[model samples]
Target chain A: MFLAFDVDSLKYDAAGLIPAVVQDVRTNAVVMVAYMNKEAVKRTLESGETWFWSRSRQQFWHKGETSGNVQKIKEIFYDCDRDTLLVRVEQKGAACHEGYFSCFHYRILPDGGVQVVGERKFDPAKVYGKNGI
Target chain B: MFLAFDVDSLKYDAAGLIPAVVQDVRTNAVVMVAYMNKEAVKRTLESGETWFWSRSRQQFWHKGETSGNVQKIKEIFYDCDRDTLLVRVEQKGAACHEGYFSCFHYRILPDGGVQVVGERKFDPAKVYGKNGI
Candidate 1:
């Protein structure tokens, strides 16, 4: 089995959640960041896809379940502290629900104003409806 | 002033902290990840260096203050949700407290084992004493 690492060894916060930094394997861009509990971590590992815990919705979230913007796991790493996780993935389609390739599309300009860095890959209105995720 | 973005607009967690993913501007490598509060964000913007809120110590931390591995800000971006920050920087030296170039030096193997991927730039014993951070 590929489940070699003990999930219990991870240091979870008081809420049993740990922040996962997701990176695009090809571009080395940080596509998104999310929280994951033990179950979500295991699911991601076994399923070979990204799964996260939705703090706001208080439920398990299988990434790209609705949008089809799945992230295939390339590698996973835990920091020296064992508190945080860094996940490298081959992202299929835009990682951002807003249709940008990355969630961090809004760059902060020198003068403190914000600017959009890249073109959107898809339209949020069409993908997640008008409200957007 | 470069502090144009209003800090209040960014969302903070219950502990008044937002996760910041630090990336290498030139290499596109994510060097480290840490937390920042409103004051820390303001300090980073004003000082052009990373300043973070230490959740464990419950105080402000100036990156590289003791290690001299400071990360100079090149660009900063916030996600659409405004709950996270992606800070691209010109890293001076090793970003990991353990002396690795990046905090994410461990790569998980297919069999679930982890292997250290990079060489240590400095000795943690020499830098942070025997115990290390």
Candidate 2:
């Protein structure tokens, strides 16, 4: 039975941040993880898109605001403790500026050398805005 | 001013997790995010590899562990807060199972329709462990 998933059940880390795992809704691949403060969480919920605070930039950033690449939230699920988030988004174009659908588009050889198994699809310096990645 | 950077100074997210931003390092693209508990951090630290906790899998998983692609950490830096991480890696293949170098490799069209600007480089169902993403 599908019951109401209680928000109280969600757990946040000591800094009021939660671990959010972004998966390729189509491919089911684990994207990256970022800490979302309560406001980031609220922004994500309110905008129906992914939003997080850039620890470095120290500001709120929408996933696609700078770049045309946007993650439209199709579904949002919380882990048992609510400390983690599983975001299902419909991505358009290359989700990465490295010219790949995912930034993970690489592999390590048995000898520890990096090998290229995919092709880059975009130029970050152009798409990521003047601010850059 | 050229001294070795201290790993101890690196800040990690709560849950003993660090906010790692996997960039193309080559293209300078931002990939997805995932929390790395202490062990995961250590694994990443000692190996010069990116290791993180799969909250869903509840275990340790290296980037491109199952996929032929892998991220060989070339450089890892910490944010001022000591809570975030900047991971520079040489991606060898598709960083995402969706067939992109990065998961954020998508951009929403002006009309709100998802568009495909990149090409798929691999078949994840075949690469990722039979367990899948």
Candidate 3:
């Protein structure tokens, strides 16, 4: 049921980071996409929770560490190139800092316009504080 | 029904590229992930086909250009950060050069092992010639 998987086998970018696409296992909705360093990957594998490398903060980010929107890992998959990762998880609360269930709430129309889809699940100000996330 | 969506609103990386996650509109299965520059994005929007910036070749890549596995865009969405894109498409043939419908056919087990999931749709040798893509 399992084949050998060496963390080193994964292809990371020049910054030693790989993008991880987080999806809701129940709904099959892509909630968010973020980058992860080797340490973050190891931590996520060992802890069964989502861990990412925040490019802006330049640090390790344990999902829902402060907002309680933790993502419990259900399954993990990698692409053929061994570069990108797909993480299926059971998400708690809103995945978007903007209060939507998923970060991809803005749909693009054919005419080069955007439309907001889905409903807001929580208030960002209350969740991530005054400045928000 | 639509809000203004200027291509300039997107936040590209320092390399002027943005990662795009391509999914099958019918199955909701993530098919592939690739980077696209502003020009590629504009081409995709205008042509209604998937186009990407190939980092290795340093050129524009039109999906299925040689293999005839073109993907017709059904819908496109952007994340809250505007740094990532979600593209829903009607894929014509195998998305993976390895002949899988999706590139993410390798699953990772809890014990840090990998497993091949899903069925291969075509023979890469025949599809992309002897060496394959």
DockQ scores of the candidates: 0.73, 0.05, 0.60
lDDT of 2 by residue, A1-133 (tens): 1122333445676666676656568765444456688778767766778888776678887887777777887756553233556666787666655556665444433343344545666777778656666
Candidate 1 clashing pairs, residues 3+ apart or interchain = A112-B4
- Residue-wise C-alpha lDDT for candidate 1, range A18-119, written one tens digit per residue: 999999999998999999999999998888899999998899999998889999998898888888899999999999998999999998888889899888
Ranking 2 against 3 by lDDT, winner: 3
lDDT of each: 0.90, 0.62, 0.90
Candidate ranking under TM-score, highest first, comes to 1, 3, 2
Residue B65 shift from truth in candidate 3, angstroms: 1.3
* Residue A80, candidate 3: alpha-carbon lDDT: 93
For DockQ, candidate 1 versus 2, the one ahead is 1
- For candidate 2, the TM-score is 0.51
Model 1 lDDT, residue B109, Cα: 74
Docking class of 3: medium
lDDT of 3 by residue, A1-133 (tens): 1223477889999999999999998888999999999989888888889999999999999999989999999889999999999999999997999999999999999667779999998998988889676
Query: Per-candidate TM vs. native?
Result: 0.96, 0.51, 0.95
Better of 2 and 3 by TM-score: 3
Q: Highest TM-score, which number?
A: 1
Choose 1 or 2, whichever is better by lDDT: 1
For model 2, the stretches where C-alpha displacement exceeds 4 angstroms are: A1-9, B1-133
Which candidate ranks first by DockQ, i.e. highest? 1
